[model samples]
Target: MALTGSLDAAAQAKAAKAEAYKAPRTAFGQPDLSGYWTNNTMTPMTRRPGVSSLVYTEDEVKKMEAEAEAEVEEGNAPTDPNAGAEAAKPAASSLRPEFAAAGGDVGGYNRGWLDPGHTVMRVRGEPRSSLITTPNGQIPPRKKGAPPPPGFGRGLGSFDSYETRSLGERCIIGFGRNGGPPMFPNGFYNNNYQFIQTPDHFVIEVEMNHDLRIVRLNAKHRTDDVRPYFGDSIGWWEGDTLVVETTHIPQSQGFMGSWKDLKVTERFTRVGPQRVHYAFTIDDPTVWDAPWGGEYEFAPLNGRIFEYACHEGNYALPGILAGARAEEQAAAEAAAAKAAEAAKSKAKDKKAGD
Candidate 1:
């Protein structure tokens, strides 16, 4: 009886300690959210095939992780130049070596450059297969007859001008939505971020392409005409949670065909000393049948952020244009040659008939 009473007292004390825990505050008495954080995880933006549920069992998670590790190993393996064509054929599940190569050229980067996390993202102690939390664990389908989003769905032949290139290829925004109002993991390298807080504003600096997002605290969003990359974000504190709303996303930078009328609301709260809980809801009546949302946890990183200089000394843009011109020149030459051959054959046939 005495031992049971002691155990109960200890449990009560522990509960009290947890109840008293509060996030550190800034000089102006706001919850301090300044830190280096990473959203890196193996969790995909949408549920993968064969994953039926949003949450995975422990055994399922282990199996998925093992498969990912095996893929990493294969990616890191050295290729033999002397190998025959039969040996070069990639597995049906894997990308062709040429496709995987940087710029679709020879001598691509090794897998060491990849830092896709080893494990699925954990939310509330459950391993999640996808970041999206819709009943289907995917983004809602586009409204019927809605026009496809700009920049995509035009097929691969639209590279006639620099403006037709993707935002990432142009170095205007981080690839894979790394800098977003509903920021998500890239499933590749440069998945870190730094959060800097001030009395009246908050800033989130993404590691990929060195993109930055600034949120004005307790302020209204900018006018509708002033669209910005990652949209115009305004934030306010609701108890311990920092609530942010973003709007005015440009049409060219739309998210999954939803940017024109999209509004993203995000909530951030420090749930533990080393973890922050992040949740976001996406609403775009112009695109989706209904709204959707997701939840994930951001863990503190020990290292400092580094700069990603995407455009310095870059020759890819000019090279692409030059390649296009070369193709056009070759096509025109071939047509002229064919026409000349036909004309010569017709003149010879006429002389023979005479």
Candidate 2:
């Protein structure tokens, strides 16, 4: 939130400092953190050991930035925020770990479909490799052989239908990983986000499905209500930072490996005119051994967030099902023709022998 709308720079600075020093409050004196923001970046959810820590060497930052810029310049950008299954670069496999699994040579979109920026964020003007601060810069692995999250219909009976797929495939949530607890950029272009702040809460609308995450500040967790698709979140202010802790995630909204017991802690701090510092910690003891966290700087954009309108426009599901039916019909017809031909050949042979 704007600092009291005072025009004086010195006064604003003083107020901001004071606000950061104290527990943050909302516009209604409750710990104000209501605004539009986004978290679409090349930064991974976890850190990479080669690029561990928020601090990056000048050479590494320059190299990484140059590569990303080259990608854009060469007209090889990403597609929609959650638009996976795209054609990756020729060297996609080599770049896999450095990039996410989304980096592939498989068929998909090009640079014309991407919106990821080239320049990495500077916390204090120094580039960071990942949002996470762990030594390895990676999320800890899930417990060995931990069962897949519930609601997964993988290997289900034939009659189970495709409803067992992820919320994204069903066009329920944002198409990509645009929404957050640890919001990371997808391979697509519209991974952009918008933030709306009100007197009591903050709403983050991801551009994909227009997935909305509402964080209620200075409030208690909703323990009695049904678990939400995006989990339950309660927010508070720690000085200038807006902190939100989320839990009670439904099985439908699994985060990578962890299932129902996952917890995410997020921090949003407006550190610059066009930028906010976004940090998050993920913990699920049943899934991981230790909590891991990361931070990324979000720069404000000029465009307005648009409605995703996925359900209305979706045609992929019907198309896939129809294609399958057509294939089955063709196969059955071919089998029947083959059987008839075989019987006719046998009758002809018998008549000739007689």
Candidate 3:
């Protein structure tokens, strides 16, 4: 790409500019955004079905949050020591669909280990009904006959090969759009990040998948048609706000399956001592008629960033493939054994007739 350069140049530039950072502000007098922050909340990227507004009333917020808080309490209550295995099964109906997986499946977290924040996402003073600020508070419709979003979920596709699995399953990147051009909450845990800004680059160290995103400052988009994770991000300072433009997003990582020609513009501004107002807009004429995205606030993460170590001690993928093969072989053996039994019975009947 005419724009893409080796990470070496970027790294060297950042190393040189590292000296320019004076706490939160660079020597250039730009607002500093170096800190550990989180965008974890109950709010989802798209609007909920049948919801008509962007902002929720205080009463509505209280009721929804109370429900979430109660669910946690119920989950945290001590279980009967002699409870049956069935008790470990995750009941999707027991919690909101958005949070049903908090319990995961059998042998997963219950409540105390879970970290889907209870509070619905609030932008400024108002509770947000949805993140997308579009007129309908939803992703705009695709052009007629536009292709469906590609890729299959763990259960929906063949798992014969590791490549067949989802990116999250392979531990290639954080699942649920965690390492995003327009980053979004994973709807699960590990939604934390550290922002390290140098005069030449802005780096977001994602706690999930240990994804490291480097944003080149005042750089040009690559014309090489290369699509990599986190895309190609170039940023500039607009007053105290850092405006970033990302393109060439990989199709598998596309937002709602709209990646080609996608350009995501994100603005990160330190709005308060404890919050950073993160806003984004997506534009892809091939997919939608107009651009649409949403805004959310990043609160300070109480803890430090830790290694995700997705592949280490993760036997789920190996187990999935091995288990599938074992099941297939068992089924084939049973079928052959049944055929042999039927042949033997037929031979005995023939002998009697003879």
Candidate 4:
């Protein structure tokens, strides 16, 4: 009787522990969300053409990945001297439209440094066709009469003071939406981040430009009517997930051409030992007819985040890349001139024979 009672007591204790289980916690006793993470995957933000479904079969994903790899390898390979202009034409079908774009010598020869993700993005082992979860795997169409978002220097900024320049041009922030409420990869490089959690605040140190997103925990929204760069973010813990609602995004930094009334709700949850599932819902009644959102999984960054002190060096690289573009333009012009000369010669010969 004593032995049986002891075994029963042990079993009861195990059951109690299971019922009260909790996720890993920080030293301050909050669910730990502090670490370096990355969301680099081959999945585009919106579904690309030819992708028929939200979730792709393993075989389909493999074929697409293989094709992308092969195309890169071919692009980087040495060109054949005897090959004609036809060699310049893109393949009839491609992994996506961007892959077919002629990125000049810089993108072709310098691809080793680019980390645009090699494998498909998987959520719970299912390879997703895109990060967006809409039925069509795209952003919902804008409302019928939604006004276009205002741009500071889309075209006209030459004569004006330097103040009129775009945020990116001024180095206020880098492009490609790396430091976003719905933080996304730059798609070219530097897709890493360091997340820090404190009792009163949550800070995200973006690798690109060292952009910092400071979230006030359990705080009320500011009503100064002044728009901020990444917007005013306030977060609270809902169980183990950090739920954040952001508003007042600057017009230049709005997501999908929304700003005045844009609101983004983000949820970051620890899903496993090495992964954190990030999801977001975007709401702007004037922009879209309904609230829409997307999701992607984040894994621990392989390396640490280094300080990115950017300033003058940014222009040096763009200038070098521009040289590559100029080279391609000159070649195209020469080819066109040669074709025209050949046509004229043929015409003159025929006229003389007649």
TM-score of each: 0.81, 0.72, 0.82, 0.74
Q: What is the C-alpha lDDT of each candidate?
A: 0.77, 0.65, 0.79, 0.75
By TM-score, the better pick of 1 and 3 is 3
lDDT of 2 by residue, 1-354 (tens): 101112245545644653454434554664433445555666654555554345666687788877877666655544455654443253552243433333344543344555665666555455566655665655555688776544333323332345754567677776445775668776355667777777668788788887889988799887674787788989887767788999888765667757577899988877655567777778888877777776667766667776666467767666666676788899999999999999999999999999
Name the top TM-score candidate. 3
The local lDDT score (0 to 100) that residue 46 gets in candidate 4 is 82
List runs of model 4 lying over 4 Å from the truth: 1-22, 71-96, 99-102, 105-109, 149-161, 309-311, 314-354
Worst 10 residues of 3 by lDDT: 1-10
Ranking by TM-score: 3, 1, 4, 2
Q: Candidate 1 at 179: error in angstroms?
A: 0.5
Backbone clash numbers for all candidates listed: 0, 35, 1, 0
Candidate 1's displacement at residue 265, Å, is: 0.6
- Candidate 4 shows a clash count of 0
Looking at model 2, report the run of 10 residues with the lowest lDDT sum: 1-10
- Candidate 1: tens digits of C-alpha lDDT, residues 148-224: 75553332465589888777878878777778878988766788999999989999989998888999999997765
